[model samples]
Target: MRSDGTLSLERRRQEREEAKLLVLRKRGSRLAFEWGLQQCVKSVNATPRLLVYLLREVCVLAGRLARGGRV
Candidate 1:
């Protein structure tokens, strides 16, 4: 970093990804959320329908836990 307060593109991308992870954790995100997102993304044949369904279920579970309800 120079006195100009500018960051390289690679450094900026790493910071952005770190910030995103922080936000997810602050919002009660869990391992299941990460796993579902990663698994679907890694699948070559992943479809919008399946992704939506998986995300929906993850959201519901997270919400339930956040509200102090049993999983």
Candidate 2:
């Protein structure tokens, strides 16, 4: 018996291939989700460092502008 109720070796092979594809798809999605979560955690932990660097750069630029009398 096949998906369409017809017995054939081709159909069985197709079904096997489809099943393998589905499993691979599920595994890929799981890995992608976990990788995204890890990236999120890394970015979250670096948030404060990013903010501090941004502010420091901003202050430096502001000082340079003031020195040029372009406040």
On TM-score, the leading prediction is 1
TM-score (C-alpha) between model 1 and the true structure: 0.39
lDDT of each: 0.63, 0.51
Q: Give the range of the ten consecutive residues with the poorest summed lDDT in model 2.
A: 45-54
Give the winner by lDDT: 1
- Which portions of model 1 miss their true places by more than 4 Å? 1-42
Q: For each candidate, C-alpha RMSD in Å?
A: 10.4, 19.5
lDDT, candidate 1, residue 45? 49
> Which tens-of-lDDT digit does each residue in 1-71 have in candidate 2?
76887878755654554454446446764443344344346655433333443455457658878899542
List model 1 lDDT by residue over 1-71, tens digit each: 65689987656654654555556656765654574467567755444544664678678988999999987
